[model samples]
Target chain A: MNPAFENITSLRAKLAARDITPTEVIEALRARCTQVEPSVSAFNHLDWDTALREAATADASLPLGGVPIAIKDVIAVKGQPCTCSSKILKGHTAVYDAGVIERLRSLGAVPVGRCNMDEFAMGSSTENSADGPTRNPWDTSRIPGGSSGGSAACVAAHEAIASLGSDTGGSIRQPAALCGCVGLKPTYGRVSRYGLVAFASSLDQIGPFTKTVRDAATLLGAISGRDPRDCTSLDQPVPDYTASLEQGVKGLRIGVPKEYFIEGMDKDVEQTTRQALDQLAKLGAELVDISLPHTNYALSSYYIIAPAEASANLARFDGVRYGARVPDGKDVLDVYSRTRALGFGNEVKRRIILGTYVLSSGYYDAYYLRAQKVRTLIRKDFEEAWKKCDIIATPTTPTPAFKLGEKTGDPIQMYLSDVFTIAVNMAGLCGLSLPCGFVQRDSTDLPLGLQFIGKAFDEATLLRASHAYEQSTEWHTRRPVL
Target chain B: MNVEYVAKLARIDLSAQEIETYQNQLGSVLEHMDAIASLNLDGIEPTAHASPVFNVLRKDEIKPSLPVEDALSNAPKKANDLILMPKIVE
Candidate 1:
């Protein structure tokens, strides 16, 4: 069997049985990537030679031993370029391993390639990348939902067994929904953000894009835990996420929020999500009708807070320390301005300016501060809803993947694409998206996603419920014929 | 929304055309954000971070730091062991 298309669980078993060596798996992935990469464009960079060398000496005894995992460009992997899909950091190689890379490396996982993303993780669509957009494998004409678009698309196209993606505002889950794969964003502090290029500091969490919920659980366990380097990382004990996967969702209360099924949502997406909920109810899980009243303000507040934090975090890119620098600057200020202007993409520049405006002298209270307080209300909504249910369910996106260049012309239209997924980030809750069913569009079958939001650090229950739902359906088994 | 002034504060140069485009786009986004202005947030404590951890202090023990060469490896301009920057004193 070709290890390229197999899930991490089966690959781990195959590696242990010595049916295939790590080198063979890498070779299979290389062949697959060579075939599909030109059309999919999932990676910014791929170092097959390095991956092969690492695979040659891989110890197959460890948990993830010899498995190749694709990494998003935002996370630092020593000797690999950490571009974040922006021109500013072009040619800048990471001198140290990110916390996640260190953890994955310890388990003998070979980090293979740098997956593409929105420049500085600013946009919902990978169209914001300077490296070019990653196309959805399901329908080549449509976009792969983004920031983590490449990570999701690569897994769906069988370019890699599993890959890592960071979710700031649905970057992981939304794209996974569009690309028809399993994506999870752990509770805010559950994973270390030491090496993730900060998009929105308080909202960012690195997670996985996989073919199966089991693979997501395994990947999440390996990368979680407190690190001294990232002060914000929770000091909680890391639980074995896969341990509870088979527990099923019997008698568990799955909250279905009324606020999510808003007007103007696609009929097919709503129907698919409802059908999935019915399947969960049929499987002995209790479905609770719930209300997260402040949901309407989530997008507005996220735009304010995220940009405000981003404007401050991105100040490090000023031409002096690293990355590109324009040569003919008459003064320091000139150098900073010219370098940044030339380096950043349009979307990145837009956010930076917007961020700067909200945090500017007179506007801070009206915009930034008010948005933070609104964030409290959003979090409280989740806090209250959790009292009635074990987890919450919603449609990951209002619609399936749109055609490329569909929303690029209008930023608000692009931002609206993430309306369903952003509230989870605002509340700092863990959320996952898995394929529920498919909707036929233009003579092609496009997949729909069902999102599950869990309490803070309660990834175990989230995984259990998701796995139970995933197994009862065959959506996870469908693959894009690239 | 003074797009030019905001761009100046952001230290990124925007062309006349880009500024006009951003002015319209950001104007609409900020208008959308106006939904939060009328909220009654009395006694609501702002959540700066989702994780409740604060003032995380590590032991002030000596640890191996990144070597100067390694640290300056990605610098745009560098001397023997230092990153060269434009003169701040004019």
Candidate 2:
């Protein structure tokens, strides 16, 4: 049987029934990756030998037994090449597994490869990747949304059964939306970030990109819970996320924020999102009109706080430590300057400089400090909305995937791609983006996603609502002809 | 915007042309950031951490760490088990 496009639940059942061995699944996936990697450019490090070897001995009793999940290069898997798709980390191999990797292993999930991403998870398009862009499987000329582009693409193209991705301001969800898959960014602190190469520490959370909402829930259940290594990891019990997958969203209040449907939103996105909401309403959900008043400030505030934190987090990548280094320097300072200049891409350098300037002595109050305060206001906006609604709904992106180089030259236009999704991260709420409809352009069907934001630790409700919508609609089943 | 000074602080070297380009780009970014000032945030506290859990303390017991081989494995320049760096204060 072709393992491609099958969800983990079905794969596990097949493994248990002895219809498919773990080695057969790994071999089939490896063959699929070989077929698609040239066009999709999905992986940086594909360890087929180790994956097949591990699959041979995998225990079927474990939850994710023998299932191969592609990992975002930003998240470390021990002994694998963890490049984050940057020249700086050219030959760097992770010495230890990320907290999520450890959890995946305990559940018997085999990591098949390190998927490409935006350099240091910085940019909306995978065009920022030093390893080259991951093309959208739906249309090879268009980009797979990023920084988790490879993670989303591999899942959409069926190179891997599921994939893990990091979302710092819509990295996972945006890519999933563009690639036509299910992506969930858990509540901040819901997943441990101990081994994730730090991008913007507070906003970055690791999540899964999967074929179905049930697979997303299953993967989230396995990879979540507290880890002592990550200080921000919530000290709470991990729920069985799949337990409520069948519970339809009856008596659920889904907020339709007027601010999200703004003047410049794409007509197709608006129409499709409205249609999805109507479908949800038909599924017994009450669509309440609500307003997240501080929504406009999210993008601006995110640009400030994320860069300020990134500047601090990225300071460790000097010439002295791990990864690539420049030897042509007279002094230590020269080495640092030369190495960083040669190492980082233009976008990363721009962000680092912007971050430094904002956190500088004179501009602290005007930019960084004030931006943090605006962050508070944004959170409060969501807090107020929760009183009247159980879930918040919006278009996952303002539009579907654009051409490869469409927004490359304009930073602001690229930043606007995440306008609908960034507020959830700033408010530290859990969000899920699932395919709802396809917008046909030039005879090519590009997928549009519907996003749902839920209260802290209320991912179960998100799963139930999205699962209901997913089951009711046929959008998730429409695979891109790769 | 003093792009050179910020680049110096970031320890990244930039050409004169790049500096001029950054000045214009970052100036606009700062202009975008100016939107935050319009909010009447008098007594609002900044959110440093999204989760309430903080100042977590763990047991003082020693735990096994990555071995010397693994620790120095990724170093660009290394001698046996130690990472090598350029001369300083000489």
Query: Each model's DockQ?
Result: 0.88, 0.85
User: Worst 10-residue stretch by lDDT in candidate 2 chain A?
Assistant: A1-10
Stretches of model 2 off by over 4 angstroms after superposition: none
Cα-lDDT of candidate 2: 0.91
Residues A47-115, candidate 2: write the lDDT tens digits.
888998889888877888889999999988888899889999998999999999999999898988999
Error of 1 at A399 (Å): 0.7
Pick the DockQ winner.
1
Give the 10-residue window scoring lowest on summed lDDT in candidate 1 chain A. Answer: A261-270
